[model samples]
Target: MKRVDVAYVLLVDEHEENVLLVKNKGPGASYYTLPGGAVERGETLEEAAIREVKEETGLDVQLGGIFSVGEAFFEERGHHTIFFTFTGKIIGGEINISLPEEIEEVTWMNLQQAEPYIHISNEFEGAIDSKTTVPYMLRDAGRYRS
Candidate 1:
């Protein structure tokens, strides 16, 4: 059976129309994205989001609500990730890049500006434009290959 991992993608507030994004450092370093990580064994998705935000960016964020849920699979990498997208309110903490291994720099971009930088998954693209809360399931075509 394939392993499944749960994670959150946080849209951190930056004033009115903008949100904070983090540039990833390692493998998927080319794209800019939200603060998130895998959900730990004993923690809930919400708890993981809060913990990941603080650990990665040194920011305290109050999760406003869940925006969407989606599955991402990279066949060549042999990984499948389930993502929970959430809207977060920045309550406190200075913007600091704490996780050097996973993140490069932190940036604040308006929602419109962020469109170009985002690595689009059909799930994410739909959620951004839709009014309904949708759960997306993505499967790798090579999931059963050896």
Candidate 2:
């Protein structure tokens, strides 16, 4: 079975007090997630991360090291998905839902405050609950295979 590659960006405030999250469009309007999507053909992972953020959040980002990873297998669909969440910082543009069809709103909140709002997946369990967030908490180099 072929695997799908997806990229996600975690943008935090410079003061390290807040994290930028995008309110996803679709069921549970209250739920939030990072700005990202599946990698497009011919686009490198880093390029995809930057593009996804700009497309979904209307913000330019400078992606940092890999922050965390999540994997899921859809047996019914006969496909597997690997999620690569990366740390990033806003470098340009302002808050806006570039693609309202895919996003609802853009907002920022500290990790603790974001915990309840985020229901992305079980793999992201301790991301906000951990006291060791930021400062390279889960950062590592990302390897891209073509």
Candidate 3:
């Protein structure tokens, strides 16, 4: 099976009550998710996290400690993916959808406001419910990392 690694940044608003999320406009089911993307070759998890946040949201961020890790599998896609999420502090830039083709909107949302829009996954859903930390589900699988 194919293997992939992705990193996401969880950035909270100044009030610490909201998180930055992306509304994607891709094929299949579209949904709002944390700002992040795939880790390119030679890129570390932290580097990917920062880069993805900037690319997706047009916001510069300082990555903090790792909050959680998860894995998923996609039988239809025939791939395996590992996901790592880290805390992030927005250092600059306004909220913008850097890539219009892939991203529809970028916004900060509290858990209650986001629950309906977010696509539920075993890995990150718990993080949203708790509102304080991300959960780790590092198991083998074949899928895209969220």
| Residues 73-136, model 3: lDDT tens digits | 9778887998887877999987777699999888778866765444446445656545455443
Best by lDDT: 3
Q: How much is the lDDT of residue 94 in candidate 1?
A: 89
- Clashing residue pairs in all predictions, respectively, total 0, 0, 6
Candidate 3, residue 98: Cα displacement in angstroms equals 2.0
**lDDT of each model, Cα atoms only?**
0.69, 0.76, 0.77
RMSD of candidate 1 to the truth, in angstroms, is 8.1
Q: How well does each candidate superpose onto the true structure, as a TM-score? A: 0.74, 0.75, 0.78
Question: How many clashing pairs does model 1 include?
Answer: 0
lDDT of 2 by residue, 23-127 (tens): 887755456888888998867778899999999888999877777667889898787999887788888998777787778788888877775544445665766
Off by over 4 Å in 2: 27-30, 75-77, 116-146
Report the number of the highest-TM-score candidate: 3
Q: Mind giving the per-residue lDDT tens digits that candidate 1 earns over 1-146? A: 25566555546354456667887876634567777878888566777888988887888988766676667787977878777777677888988988787787888887767754444454466344443444444455774588
Q: Which ten-residue region of model 3 has the weakest summed lDDT? A: 134-143
Q: Which stretches of candidate 1 lie over 4 Å from their true place?
A: 12-15, 116-146
